[model samples]
Target: MADNTSRIVYEMTISHAEFFRTLPAVMGALPYVVDGSEVSALQDTRRLKINLSPEGRRNFGPIPLPVTHVELGFDGYSHEETQAFL
Candidate 1:
């Protein structure tokens, strides 16, 4: 077990609900499992705080090259659960 804590800052233009769903997939692709407790989502501001681990670092292996910015398209997933919580 390595006590390695890393911080990754990503600029994702996604809604709050969409981010909740997509985050799992994105984090899953990383080498480490995200510590949800340390995850902070500020959708209103389009900001996300993710506390990563060694496995995450190993999996993601640093940020992408050139660091191109892109927009994410959200489907019905955003509204599907809206009414449930309301």
Candidate 2:
């Protein structure tokens, strides 16, 4: 693992409701530290929520409709090793 901390930033478009619904599955695919947080929102909508977990665990309900896009941000160490893993 590299000493430097890095962040993974990406964008996705999804409905407000759908975003909340799939939050858990999305977060599960990410490599967060033991304790981490996730901040989410809808495009152009004022609705937003921030969830924090000391164990880096996230739980989101099922989304009925499709999510348009989503913006994902992750921060952690092992910056150099990440590329090889990907």
Candidate 3:
């Protein structure tokens, strides 16, 4: 257990039907600032952002990771729509 190679696994199971049932409400409450073409709780490849870590430097060496904020198509649906979905 003390070895650095030790790994931890997490497993959570939710039925597909249940997953979709709550997706709309969940999406409506989370806030993201990206201007994506479409905004939905659904997993769309075009809407996701790619964040890379600042690793592997040849000169000054590595520094602390900077704070990051992810932008999205927009903040969830809206207060009214979110309430209805919930």
Q: How far is candidate 2 from the true structure (C-alpha RMSD, Å)?
A: 13.0
Show how many residue pairs clash in every candidate, following the order shown. 4, 7, 3
Candidate 2 similarity to native, TM-score:
0.33
Candidates in descending TM-score order: 2, 1, 3
At residue 12, candidate 3 shows an lDDT of 22
When 1 and 3 are scored with lDDT, the better candidate is 1
TM-score of each: 0.28, 0.33, 0.24
For candidate 2, give the lDDT of residue 66: 31
TM-score of 1: 0.28
Query: Lowest summed lDDT over 10 consecutive residues: which window, candidate 2?
Result: 66-75
Model 2 clash pairs?
A: 12-69, 12-70, 13-68, 13-69, 13-70, 14-68, 14-69
Model 1 Cα lDDT, one tens digit per residue, 1-86? 22223332444434344544666666443233324424544333233345422221112356332221223222222343222212
The alpha-carbon deviation from the true structure for residue 39 of candidate 3, after best TM-score superposition, in angstroms, is 9.8
In angstroms, the error of model 1 at 10 is: 0.3
Clashing pairs in 3: 33-72, 34-71, 34-72
State in Å the error of residue 15, model 3: 0.2
